[model samples]
Target chain A: MRGYSGDKDAYLKRLRRIEGQIRGLQRMVDDDEYCIDILTQVSAATKALQSLSLGLLDEHLKHCVAEAVAEGGDAADEKVREASEAIARLVRS
Target chain B: MRGYSGDKDAYLKRLRRIEGQIRGLQRMVDDDEYCIDILTQVSAATKALQSLSLGLLDEHLKHCVAEAVAEGGDAADEKVREASEAIARLVRS
Candidate 1:
């Protein structure tokens, strides 16, 4: 996750904005915003969240995961499994 | 995307596997696998894909996007817009 660590501040900022958007969406629901509108916002938030996750996963695979594989320990397989499980969870969700 | 470039070969291999998984999912659909099973596989494939995307996005934000922002060019804003739009598209899907 070397790439991830390089610009930590900016990434966190984006995440904060997305977090606020999610809260705003929740508030919209509380205020009885139109169904489609809420759904639309929900979709946006989901995408934002997904984008963030995608970025992190990409870094993991490119850096940490790859390094682990190169190192070739029990941890390497564990990392692979963890990655797979993460994907599984995403699909199940 | 510096981190991504560093281990390109390994990353491509993982992508190849995911690609195969997606093809398998398509075949399952063609064969009319049970709806739940098909859905399960679809979900898994989606998650696998999302994971891959997330990793790449993370690298871009950390490396490419961050460098663009740091350089302070028109490209910086363009990159930001691209990222936002990417997120929007994901949500819409």
Candidate 2:
């Protein structure tokens, strides 16, 4: 509700579709789909996941992190830590 | 360089600080900061991290996902899977 605010439903719907895609990929692998084809599909899925992750990260910066920085309290420090962990995930992924 | 392509330096700087914040939190825990205070800090950090994650997710959706969906090829299906995994992470987090 915080950053997602008005876009929750849309975001969730998108996520559900992505999930289906993943399941499909699993099926493809199970069926012994061609290696290149499976990899192509995997690459596409990876890109999509990256897109979604980036979107959420942007919202967080614009709203929560920005606000905390402006407010300058314990909250700000905490936000910094939170943001760091998120970035770590992004980097690893 | 996909989504963060334009903002790479800025993003990296922000992430570095977040890492510091996390380290600070670890120190706080080690020093036995008040339970409430530690939790408060943890909460703040958690929120900040969520913000960052959401931001990245947003960008991915707007750029990569949108493009793939438009193209409607193997790419689109892969994107769908990728997006789904990202969402799953968000939800679990």
Candidate 3:
């Protein structure tokens, strides 16, 4: 229950909408919508996602990393490393 | 005007909501809600994000990568590489 076990409904609700958005984007393509229009949708979708990732990263830092720091030891080091890697991935995206 | 220049309003709208969700999670934390509950929110948030990334990746493959494949050459290679890197990052996340 410590990992990915909470707020399932809320997450699912948001994801369902995002999924619809993606499908709508596909229709735009199938209909041969302007290339720029499609790219714009893609950008918007990606930004929505990037915002989500950033939020998760923020939580990880506040909770997971902070907990590790309190414990003090290898767990602390590992959590920091994991958080750093997550940050790097977000940066690259 | 090619990249991320289309559907700007739609993108902004979606992002705004996702932002609200993140803030909700943060408030959950500040209130000292159960760790698992907070984690559940984190999981939900991360999954939402992963879904978004996957959508963008899908569009990139269908449109950006497809265009490059049609051209065939250094540009093709670059586009494929970029797409691949994006995939690798998503997978890792």
Candidate 4:
């Protein structure tokens, strides 16, 4: 079981919503919508993805990392390191 | 005709690819993939959206905003202001 397994339904819903947003962007382009308007939608989609990332990260830290820390071994250290790297990627993205 | 009209097909292709990425993310979640792995894919999708925004913004500045500025009127100022606001939103997102 993964850290996000419990929230799987919620995460899938968010991803599907974001998928709809991406489709909306394609439609806007097909109709020759104004560039700024398209960019605005792009920003909205990006923000949604970012929010999802943050939520997943929170759950990973709270569950995965916490469980590893409770075990107190090299696996715990590796999990923490992996989570940190994921956080960095999320921030930079 | 919009600034991106010339690149419409290319833009559509990119958006479609991002849509695919979003769907792939949904699959990852449904399969109970590791949290960090899911986060990685989320970052990839977010980065793709950002790159698409930058491409569209560049074209907008070169065409829409440029044409308005060349006309030299209140509309030009408004276009520039709108572009700036869009840039701000992109950065904040």
For each candidate, report its DockQ versus the true two-chain complex: 0.05, 0.03, 0.06, 0.95
TM-score, per-candidate, Cα-based: 0.49, 0.48, 0.49, 0.99
Model 2 regions more than 4 Å off:
B1-93
Question: Which pairs of residues clash in candidate 4, taking residues 3 or more apart in a chain or in different chains?
Answer: none
lDDT (10s digit) by residue, model 4, range B1-93: 999899999999999999999999999999898999999999999999999999999999999999999999999999999999999999999
What total of clashing residue pairs does each candidate reach? 10, 37, 2, 0
For model 4, what fraction of the real interface contacts is kept? 1.00
Candidate 1 lDDT over residue span B14-53, tens digit each? 8898889889878988898889997888778777777676
TM-score of 2: 0.48
Please give, as one word, the docking class of candidate 4. Answer: high
Q: lDDT by residue for model 3 over B6-55, one digit each (tens)?
A: 54455445545555556676566455554444445545555555555565
True contacts kept of 2: 0.00
Q: What is the TM-score of chain A in candidate 3?
A: 0.86
Clash-forming residue pairs, model 1: A54-B54, A54-B55, A55-B54, A55-B57, A55-B58, A57-B55, A58-B54, A58-B55, A58-B56, A59-B55
Better of 1 and 4 by lDDT: 4
- Candidate achieving the largest DockQ: 4
What fraction of the native interface does candidate 1 get right in terms of contacts?
A: 0.00
Ranked by lDDT, the better of candidates 2 and 3 is 2
Question: Could you list the iRMS of every candidate?
Answer: 10.2, 12.3, 9.9, 0.6
